[model samples]
Target: MSRHLLIETQGPWAGRECASFVRDAAALAGGGHRTQLLLLQEGVLGAVPGVLPELDGYLAADGDLLVDRYSVAQRGLKQEQLVAGSRLVDMDEIAGNVLDAAVKVVWH
Candidate 1:
């Protein structure tokens, strides 16, 4: 299976597309692809519980959810406030993934 790096920088509050994008990622993972959803900037808001219900399905399908540490601090979000299994990562990690030849990067 191929790997996909789906980078989301906006939250559902920004528009209706965020939730759809997450669902797409979940579908990809459910289809046996290695899909990772990286939430950065205002996208971290989606990491909050109940913000994006699609997150649960995404995680259940073995999709990885990565939240930006800097964004969390900048927005004053607590560690416990994020969704379960969500990983707090640095830019270095994002950079590494984005640079990986096996990863297909998509920013939304």
Candidate 2:
């Protein structure tokens, strides 16, 4: 059966861990699992344009890339400044919908 994977990232995207998460999310999506990469805290930096190329492949694999709305506002980033496929989602959506619907959730 296909599984829903939700990955919650909470640190700066410039780190090795963030890069690894992108690669892993791509792998999971390519393997036929539905993947969602949710950026929170400093992780919202990953949604910024030109910051990380690793996200391109993940997005190509049909990953649902999202940034926390609160995080974006906190960092003074506009919704339009995020990467092309990334969307701004509220915490309620993350906690009440995404997390509850995912077969597995990982924090990176």
Candidate 3:
């Protein structure tokens, strides 16, 4: 069975929390569980390429991750500004992914 992890990043606290989750999740991927990260609100800032430390490690894994378009727009991010592999998905997709995951980690 494939396991899924959902990370809900929504506020100031999420800046550090989401990054840690990405790092930890990437490390854990070798064990077989799939990880997905969702960034909403201020958390969208983390989606910006090159801003976070050791981002290459997380990107190398290519896990399923989504950033809220509404949130990104509110924060002044366009699709062109995103990290090379990041996707700007709709809210419905984000919510549904969260519901489908085995673990939902929320950083608020």
Candidate 4:
């Protein structure tokens, strides 16, 4: 199966676009693709509950969630504050995903 990596650079305040992105990611996962939603920059804010409930739906759809370790720590977000099923990953891992030929990357 192909892998889809969706990078979210915007926070929840960025509006419907962010939610729509999560929805699209979920759809990809539900369709049997390997989908991953990466939260970077202010997008790390979405790791918290209620910040982006759509994230929960994405997880339910079998999509993986990744929060940039640097972004979360820089924003003072603790591991416990993140949504369940979300993983904190190094920037290098993110770069690897983007550079991988087998993975499709989408940044917004």
Q: Give the TM-score of candidate 4.
A: 0.97
Put down candidate 3 lDDT per residue, 29-99, tens digits, no spaces.
Answer: 54556666666777777777766644467667766657789989987779888777777889787667657
**Candidate 2 segments exceeding 4 Å error:** 12-14, 98-102
**Displacement of the residue 54 alpha carbon in candidate 1, Å:** 0.9
In candidate 3, the residue pairs with backbone N, CA or C atoms under 3 Å apart (3 or more residues apart, or in different chains) clash, namely none
Please report how far candidate 4 places residue 51 from its true position, in Å: 1.2
* Alpha-carbon deviation at 12 in model 1, angstroms: 1.0
Candidates ranked by lDDT, best first? 1, 4, 2, 3
What range of 10 consecutive residues in model 2 has the weakest lDDT sum? 5-14
Q: Which stretches of candidate 4 lie over 4 Å from their true place?
A: none
Instruction: Give the alpha carbon lDDT tens digit for every residue of 1-108 in model 2.
Output: 455545555555356878888888899988878777888888888888788778899999988898899988998999889999998888787876544754677776
* 4: Cα error in model 2, Å: 3.5
lDDT of 1 at 82: 98
Over the stretch 12-97, how does candidate 4's per-residue lDDT look in tens digits? Answer: 89888999999999999999999999999999998898889988779999999999999999998898999989999998999999
